[model samples]
Target chain A: MDISSGVTETTIKSKKTVKKQKITKGNMTPYLFILPSFILIVGFLFYPIGTVFYYSLQHYDVAAPFYNGFAGLDNFVTIFTQDKMFLPSLLNSLKWVVTEVGLQLIFGMILALLLNQTFKLRGMARAVAFIPWAISGVLASSMWSLIFNEHMGVLNDLLMKLGLINEPQAFLASTTTAFTSVILAELWRGIPFFAITLLASLQSIPVDLYEAAKVDGASRWKTFIYVILPQLKNTIVLTTLLRVVWEFNNVDLLFNLTGGGPAHSTTTLTMYIADLAVHGSNFGYGSALTVITFAILLLFAIVYLKLSRYEKE
Target chain B: MIFNNKKADKLITLYLPLSMMLCFTIFPLYWTINTAFKPEGDIIKRPLQYLPANPTIDNFVNAWTNIGFATFFKNSLIVGVATVIVVLICSTLSGYALARYQFKGKRGFMLMLLCTQFIPRAMMIIPLFIIFKNLGLISNPLSLIITYSAVEIPFTTILMSGFISGVPKELEEAAMMDGCTKLQSLRYVVFPLLLPGIVATGVFTFIYTWNEFLIALMLTNQQNKFTLPVGLASMMGEFNVNYGALAAGSVIALIPAILLFAYAQKHLVNGMGGAVKG
Candidate 1:
């Protein structure tokens, strides 16, 4: 027994020594492993972002190369003063982010709670519910467009049958209805994201917590308030912030469904930027707007993080 | 009697609301599919055919051949597959590094990754256009493949590291003690367990690449190089739209993403949950 014990102890000590040796040797393998990711990120993301700042200061229109030169803050001034779309588009972006994230979170929380319950066909139901999460923004736009189409749209057919409208309304073509219609379509896609994330967090909560709440004579609503929401605080805050960033940058649905149309009623800042990049031929001005966007987002993120105190937990 | 009441409550609280949500979620897709199967003339018939009176595959045929969805689909496939491969390799290696090593700049590297998450994707459009244009890779598949791989790497690396951390290091160490090289141990022991994570990451990247529009639109202007989303967007912009072929094109785009999501959703949800929680 002593001999065997001694042998095992020596082996363990030798293993520790090996580990120490591995660390002390200053292994290059890890750096080598991380190099490709580092290179790609630097080359594409960081380098491009850096160029946005650089280009923001220059007059770099592809159409008018003769006018191209350093234009120190001229583009920003134009955006704030000369450009009409900047302020309204910024407001639209705020509206877009708030509505999309708020509605998504509320419905998503409810969906997550429902999915968390023990039920038959739970797996299949989850798969079905998250179908929208997997569908591309463009595809979702197409699907919604088909429903919003005036002549052959099922929505028009349904509305007429209900006697809600005497004539088929062109939802996307009208400014008043276009934003809301797009929001509803995006909401269908956005909710599943929150549901999936919230459900995952929900699953991680111990059953004993619920049982403990029950033992304390807490009702279901009370239990949820006391037990569930607190546990979900971190996930909620993080996902909301992430979702805000994502939705702010999202132009797919807006671009396809409305083309920021009906007189640019649906043009968020991102959509405006996309239009400029795609068609406007004003790279310098677009870059300046993009910089402002980045600044706003950074400001929002910092303020939001401070407010949520996300790191406190 | 109390038990019966509880069952009724479950029906109302759980099944009723869930079904409604499901309807809202699935209806658009169902509507699209319904339209896709209808003949071109039947699609616009009065009272709007809830179901195609005469189901046909002609729209699919037309979309695949006439509207050039075939080329778009092939281009999307190439970009998606290539990006996924690059992301998997880069993320796996970096993830293994982060999971195993106590290296300098580790915290900084992690912060860098997190910072990338907050970088507005819209900010990349103009500069990326210039950079790629300067590189003379405008409309090239290589531009897209490179851009997407970079965009996807940060998230996938974090996810991959989480997955690798879940794999206990002791197993690999034990294999090393049993006279196997680190590479061999990883190949034999860790790789099998990491397969699900790799699949989750791959699916995530593939879906993003498949569905991405703005960058794809900006990068690839050629008709033949358009990905599915770009192609779909262009088709939507036409003066006289073909709803049948459009819906048919949508279903074609929808299938791969949905199938992949359905297949790997279990890992995806759990992995995402872990990532978000962190």
Candidate 2:
């Protein structure tokens, strides 16, 4: 009705028609833009995942190619039934993830809180704190290795100077301490990840919420429990899930630092799978192990996300 | 009373703990750099020199020329730069589409991106190795670059779309209103605005490709094609495991990552926050 009669209406109608044509013409642009990424992800990521399942079903070993062809469920069967390393490595993976993620969360939250405080040199402190987050796993392993060296390590040197030990005890040599040793080294690097993520979330919290708590005369612990914890819940859940997946898959520190160790004490499931892939030459078995690893992860992700979601509701 | 409380609190709360943590955080880095500069004799001395008494660059010389870190560094650079360029181009385009388009299965596309996060990297190695071996790409730089691009795309796409969404749609539309094509608008108007996000994403992708150990370890059999992390790991596994040369090589590897990270740290924080929120 407000078209202002036929002459004006024609111009507006023509404009609308042109706009529709342009929109239709631009429809292919999105698909075109996504083509390269789609190809790469499908080719490298998704296709490889599919082949993992395929190769698991067929006997394939690189070094001993004599045993190659359809395996059916045999490769999977051997992993669960016969492999000694499977159970222990799975246990180690659990231990690695729990201790690593748990400690990283606590320390990261503390670091985030401490860094969040208004102080001079805050920028410099934050930058310095995040430096470890930037370095590679191998570099981190190397840095920590130098410090953990029994004869030349500053750690042993400091302990002796402080009269804390009678002699240089090899921390990473014994079974009891080797896992903890790797955990600590990983923690040094891992803590920064939590700190960075938590700090970002912490900064997002409205300052007035704190001011409101203070005005109500809440204690510090009460303020954090009531105010900070609730706000950080979602971030904590998501980041921890991401961290768990990452830590479970990570094998570098163990591989380089201890070479899965003096007694196979520190071998995680990822390390075990990596070992099979690298040295075992049992491709079908390795692929089967890869498939099992995938199943465990899928189960984990589903359960964790479900539990987290259920808890949220 | 508050001022008095503040000063005491500052001492116990801020100054002491911060320094302790900072020291814990910094000492390893300091140790690595310090060890890099020391001669062989000084490194293992019983009364440890906290500062190098006789600092020398001989370790650097040895690592660079003799230990073949020179080759490793070059290889790492090639892979890292190639991966970043490919990731940037791919992710930026995909990100733009996700941000602006209302195509079918867009939600599925986003979900697929999120789902990729949980794909165990350990598992990826098996099939990737087989795939590369089949393609005759096992020891080639192309394998690493391609895999890295694939490995990085999902997160970077997510990061990038978050960034693109932050840019107002009005800007692109306005450039179109001024008779520029959509591509022209993206090239001129949007790209300049998106540069910081691009830099943040690029820096992250570069650092990842540079430092990634296991994939590089699996893919390359030849010693010459070894990236820094793989090269360094091989050194670590060596029976002799020369500490001076190892530390020196580590310092070399650390330089670009730390420098790039230092420059992009602010954008990185924002970028992560943005990605998470999106």
Candidate 3:
């Protein structure tokens, strides 16, 4: 934060030259190069998004396709009026995002800070620690499910051996532990992402700042407060914002693990919508929920961008 | 004394915590691998075996042959390779444009890429299903390849642009000024230096395609059409829930992703750092 920005500015002087190139000089080469991705994005990505909004207004149930037609605002009205699972699932989504991102951020920062120091075997340690980042959400859920299984679960075995319990506890079967269990499983995978990103940014901080803090006889906590955190300001804000959005929309682990669960205790808004789309065949209602979910995410994204002043980037 | 203090501090601050976290990170994987080799009886046996006593390949065999992870693996590989090819090509071209050229709507396009990150997959499921179903491509691998490429393009473009920009433009211009055509210069000069970055980007896209679940689940219904994630998921739903085979299936799914990651992770870390730095 002290002098890093000023240093990188002179380094990027060449990038400034490239940025100022004229359209006439480049001509249609860029357009031709970009056309394929543009076409695909428009056809597949943008078109699907547009239809999500469109179908949010129409009755498009796959099961009852004969009855499918213009639904107008009926789906939305019913979402607010008749959908009982909607509000609860929305709340669950919030709880999931806050808890998951919060824990991931905290632990990830700890892990990043830990690995940032020069030490023996640091490379090997970093490699091993970041391995979970490669595992998919479904695979992660399955791996954890085995560990949390009522019978033959290692946790239950350890607990019984230690005289903590008499018998196996179905951690995923009970509402109380289902949400937390999945969250723990996801954290195993999620933390590595934040750790990796934060670690990368951590490496970019200048050594001079730390040496200066040392010369001033600053304690470690004070050094972090005065020097490190300020330099990491943008990265922390951006990563946390991204993590919040990702955690909010993430449904794969929950979908596979609990299937929105023993008492719907773990059904996130996205999970609920996905359940509706995949199982209920109520495409209209699901689309409406999708719209609502997107609106929530959009609102969060806008608010977060404004708060962080990151949109300017 | 100062050196000793530093060592002690590093021990307190670094090694202990890193080791603890590493155990947490690697345990699930270890358990999966451990379970993969264990006999079914040994998996459920009393007094849990940390080591697989009488390790067997039965689970792998069962998952590959009986549980149809063979098909899943093949399908995942096909989709992943195709998506990687398309994404790398499109994103490289698009990324080069963003990096090297100035154009109208460039800011708009860049902003569009950023905006794509926030779009929920739930929103896409219904419409994508309808669109694919209408196209009679619901069970087709092409639908997955197409959708995966599109969804991935925006980010990959951003990544590729970062990579492209890191390559000095003067080098490309120098090649061009040396009486080489633009494509020729690009082929001869820029492509070599850009290979690592391209591989990094390609690996990222491949992993995404390989591990993607919801979209794959939404698009595919046929057993043969199922990707690794979808196949593993379907197996998890069985009433008895074959723990050994499931763990084995998880292992099979884990291989390509983890292997590719192990290979490309250095670039990934650097690429990621470069991205956030900008």
- Among these predicted structures, which one has the highest lDDT? 1
Q: Chain A TM-score per model, please list them.
A: 0.94, 0.93, 0.90
lDDT of 1 by residue, A1-313 (tens): 9999999999999999978987875479889999999999999999999999999999989899999999999999998888999999999999999999999999999999999999999999998998899988999999999999998999999989999999999999999899999999999999999999999999999999999999999998999998999999999999999999999999999999999988999999999999999998989989999999999999999999998994665
**Docking category of candidate 1:** high
Lowest lDDT 10-residue stretch of candidate 1 chain B? B263-272
Share of native C-alpha contacts between chains A and B (below 8 angstroms) recovered by candidate 1: 0.94
Ranking by DockQ: 1, 2, 3
lDDT of 1 at A290: 94
The candidate with the higher TM-score, 1 or 3, is 1
Interface RMSD of each: 0.7, 1.0, 1.0
In model 1, state the lDDT of residue A240: 98
Residues B50-125, model 3: lDDT tens digits: 9998999999999999889989999999999999999999999999999988877889888888888888877788
Q: Is candidate 2 or candidate 3 better by DockQ?
A: 2
Question: On residues A1-313, what C-alpha lDDT tens digit does candidate 2 reach at each position?
Answer: 5657876889989889978966897679888989899999989999999988999998887776777888899988988899999999999999999999999999999899899999988999999999999988999999999998887788888889999987886777879878988999999999888888888888899999999999999998899999999998988988998999999999989988887876999999999889888877887888888888888888998899899899888
Q: For candidate 1, lDDT tens digit of each residue in B130-225? A: 899999998899999999999999999999999999999999989999999978999999999999899889999999999999899999889999
Stretches > 4 Å off in candidate 1: A1-16, A310-313, B1-3
Write the number of the candidate with greater lDDT, choosing between 1 and 3.
Answer: 1
Q: Tell me the lDDT of model 1 at A155.
A: 93
Worst 10 residues of 1 chain A by lDDT: A18-27
**Using DockQ as the measure, which candidate wins?**
1
